[model samples]
Target: MKILIADDDPSSILYLQDMLGEWGYEVEVAVDGNAAAEILRRSDGPLLAILDSMMPGMDGIDVCRGIRQSDTERYVYMIILTSRVESEFIVAAMNAGADDFISKPFNDEEMRVRVRAGRRIVELGEQLRRRASRDALTNIYNRGAIIEILEKELSRQGRSQHAVSILFCDVDNFKAINDTHGHLAGDEVLRVLARRMAATLRPYDSFGRYGGEEMLGVFPDCGLEGALEVAERMRAAVAEAPVKTEFGDIDVTVSIGLATVDKDQTCKLATLLQRADDALYRAKANGKNCITIAH
Candidate 1:
């Protein structure tokens, strides 16, 4: 993990930089609080930051407050560095969203422990984020994450005008499977199909569990023709093999509905999703196991 050191004092920056480097951390340096704030706002920036309390502009507390106001999805653990360890100052820094604090002329041992703790906290936050975004049953992205992915794709398409496609997939006769075997067996079938179909996707493509017995696939920079090929592979993945569960072996087939936004067109996320869903309805109406495209 990378750590950012933001301070104006040359001697203080050099001392802290050397100390942190010795502890095996990749260090990023900023001469002013404004520079530090820019780095902290980046999505790929370091998770841990040490800010000087009295930088010339945009002081440590102000920077921390600024970062807290941005997206709270991916957390940045911030520590305020100050020469004074007064109770009043510490209280003010904590209120501004500083995760930890270190006083100037700081003890080397204390700094080491705090840095270690900061990394652990950042990792824990990431784990919690993953847990919240993933579906509990199939281990794919949950419904909310799928919608988020769709929105992001639409935004990117508007900028680049590159082709994007989506697939709406539903398991055929899923409720019948539950009635015949058991709910546990049906769950196993969903998990198996999710893993199988996901294995066939390109590196940039994403597959998610949209809801019960339904899945969504997002394809970036892919046209209708390319998406059709990918959708066929996903359909075959489910039909080729029987899912083995505690109850029994069950045969499964998946129906896919594909929608594409060509490179020349820009559309809303809702419109794209609605087209795919309508195509899915057509696929179901045509036959149980098949693929249909929304023109």
Candidate 2:
């Protein structure tokens, strides 16, 4: 893990850097509050930070406050160093979002223990977030997470004037497969198909399990034609390959419904989703294993 040490005191910075480096952590240093804040603003910034209570321009408290107030999604395990053992100082640090505190004259053993605690907390948070956002069966984004992504992209398009598109995909005859082959075999088919369709999508595209036997794909900066082409490819990929399950090789097909937002139009996420879903139903009505584009 990478750790940031923000302190104005050169001697203290050197001491912590040397010790932290020896302990197998990549160490980064910041001489004052402004530099520290800049580093924390970066997407690839260190997740663990130790800030000195007193620094020029911005103190550790101010830096901590800024981090808590920022739009960052990741959590930073922050520690505040202070010379005073007063209760008010500890309260101030806690209010400013400091995760832990170490006295200015840091103890070697105490530092190790606190740092270990910080790592544990950060890891636990990451694990919980993954569980919440991921679908257990297909290992793709869950329904809630995909819907949230769609909403966010719609909001972004309003500001950037970029086109966005979505594909609502439903597996054809999936219920019949489950009835004939059993639920376990049906699950294997869903997992295999999820991997295959995900491979067909662009790296920037977001693919997720919308619900049972249904998937969703979000394409950013893509128009109607682009989305339709991708959707056709995805349909072909499913039809061409057989999903190998423990029971047997099961041939499956998918129906896709595509909806796109042009640069000039403003669309709500709910409306966009409804259009794609309606198109999906149309595709089913037209016949299984086909693509329908929502105009």
Clashing residue pairs in all predictions, respectively, total: 0, 0
Among these predicted structures, which one has the highest TM-score?
2
lDDT of 1 by residue, 56-151 (tens): 789999999999988646799999988988899899889989999998778999999998999999999999998999999999999999889888
Expressed as tens digits, the lDDT of each residue in 26-119 for candidate 2 is 9999999999999988877988999999999999999999999998878999999989889998998899899999996889989998998998
After superposing candidate 2 on the true structure, give the runs of residues whose Cα lies further than 4 Å from its correct spot: 7-45, 70-73, 199-204, 221-240, 285-291
Highest lDDT, which number? 1
Q: Supply the global lDDT for candidate 1.
A: 0.92
Q: Which pairs clash inside model 2? A: none
